[model samples]
Target: MKIGLYVLSIVCLLLIGCGDEKDSTPLVETTNKNQKPAITSKAIEDFDYTDYALSPESEEALANWEKYQELAIQIGYLKKADLSFFNGEIEDLKKFIDQFKTETPKQLLTNSIISRTAILETMLLKLNENLTLENIDDKLKLLSVRELLVAFSNLNYQINKKLESDIFNEIQPE
Candidate 1:
């Protein structure tokens, strides 16, 4: 009977020793607003659209300059690489892209411009959809944003190229 008690006590002591230690320190709940993840550091590079500048001629051809301005502002937001801000601005960005695509200037209404806009629209929709899903990856969101930005830049480049071609053709001998 004494041996039995000793064995039971040893088992109890082993179980107690194997138990997880509970932290006695109370966790303070502080609301940390706008907390950025460490992975976001230097994740996106600054986009310079200066080289892709629309000539004065192309700028003047805009059916809705305000739409273009709004797009520029959104691009600025993307350049800042703030994922949360980008997620919040997705709807507004969609509106801007839709307006710009629909109201494309007559002079710049090339197949390339149309295709680029379509690509951009698709990318935005995909990103927005991913963000709505449960436990979406941040890296995936960043990649989508990058692709969308590239599509926008391509649209600008196509517009400038088209405008320059038109201008050059006008100057050539008939």
Candidate 2:
């Protein structure tokens, strides 16, 4: 009985140890924050992006309207990367996003518009640098897209923080 109990304890310890195993994959380093794990391209692509569901833009263009609309648009473009089955369409996505800058009311500091925007530009440049669809199997290339949900969340937080003052509480419907 003593031996059986001892073996059970050993098994329990092993199980606990296994639970703490470090993730085998490493993510690309992001300067956005110091506390959270640097999100990897693979992890990013693997994430469920529906959480940032963007609704059709309200004509009023409320304070958060830009964040919501852009997120939806960004996700649609990113799907191209996912369908490639690897990193195949990353370059195309980058080109589309890069050349897509347009002036509009909801354009916040973190949006693709405003070349001077910080986080948007950083993400643009990073996506451009990685996720190139070159020479690899189309299926294999699909894996390069990173989870943009985190990136999107970060942008929302930044936008809210920066626009707290000037942002209209709720734009009155015309």
Candidate 3:
């Protein structure tokens, strides 16, 4: 009876120890802030994009670009706030952004625009990494989503600024 009890204790200890195994995936480096992460689901439409009309050349380029269409659809998914397939949507967005970075249309190839897209791509990658962690919290997920939206908005602003400048240049006396 003594030996059986000893063996049972050892088995219980082993099970407890195994239960504490840490996840292998590394966490994204975060600031040691004690504050709770805020949900920053700002509406994309709030950004003033009205003044930056795309030129006919840019419109035609976007119309013909399947990657750009895919990008827009992905953004639409994010905008919808549908949590059912949110993980898959983020994954899809990351892939589309990667492709868009390399195949930007000629009319949209300004240095600033390209730089902004690169920043957006980096944000998406970080979000993807965060999602891959085994113990992701809602705060981290929401914060990452907010960051992703901000990066995309910045890219849109750059593109619009470039288009506006191009239009202004065309109307100016040479």
Estimate TM-scores for all models.
0.64, 0.35, 0.58
The Cα local distance difference test for each model comes to: 0.70, 0.47, 0.66
Model 3 regions more than 4 Å off: 1-61, 83-95
Candidate 1, 10-60: lDDT as tens digits: 999999998998998999987566777523436666433333666687777
Q: State which candidate, 1 or 3, has the greater lDDT.
A: 1
Best by lDDT: 1
After superposition on all CA atoms, what RMSD does each candidate show versus the true structure? 5.7, 17.8, 11.1
TM-score of candidate 2 against the unseen true structure: 0.35
lDDT of 3 by residue, 8-53 (tens): 9999999998896788999988866686433233543343343233
Error of 2 at 35 (Å): 35
Write down the lDDT that model 1 would get.
0.70
The number of clashing residue pairs in model 1 is 0
Off by over 4 Å in 2: 1-71, 76-116, 133-144, 161-174
